[model samples]
Target: MPGWEDRARIGWGPGAAPTTTVQVEACPAASAPAAWSVYTGGTWVASPACVPLVIRSEGQQVEVRLAIGAACGENN
Candidate 1:
């Protein structure tokens, strides 16, 4: 393994933010709970808020679990 050097530049271009896929589940009314909320950090808030959910940095990959119920008068 002499004179074997790994040389390469790896990164995104300008205006390119790191992309990652998030897993979200839209439960059916039958399977949805009567009323549920999500446990964010230390406090629990109303699930399925219109605002975007923020995730904490851990490593290259992470998994988040959120329990959301059905909307008012909506099935699934």
Candidate 2:
């Protein structure tokens, strides 16, 4: 599937622009006991990566996939 990931990725919250930086946690809420991510480590992003997040409440959980990547910008 060429665009399978594109179709699978889940996103929400304020629209964000990507940047290659080894800083910023992927999802802060996921770190809490209420939520978690299937993909672990690499809190900071320097390249394209995929993260599957699970949020739980009242014995139920919703799964979402996050796609993080580099944003194009000036070469300089």
Return the TM-score for candidate 1, rounded to 2 decimals. 0.19
User: For model 2, how does the per-residue alpha-carbon lDDT over 3-30 read when each residue is reduced to its tens digit?
Assistant: 3434233333344333222123356654
Collision pairs in model 1: none
Winner by lDDT: 2
In candidate 2 the C-alpha lDDT for residue 46 amounts to 38
* Candidate 1 per-residue lDDT over residues 32-75, each given as its tens digit: 76776442222223344222233444344443333333243222
Clashing pairs in 2: none
lDDT for every model? Answer: 0.32, 0.43
Candidate 2: where is the Cα deviation over 4 Å?
A: 1-43, 70-76
Worst 10 residues of 1 by lDDT: 1-10
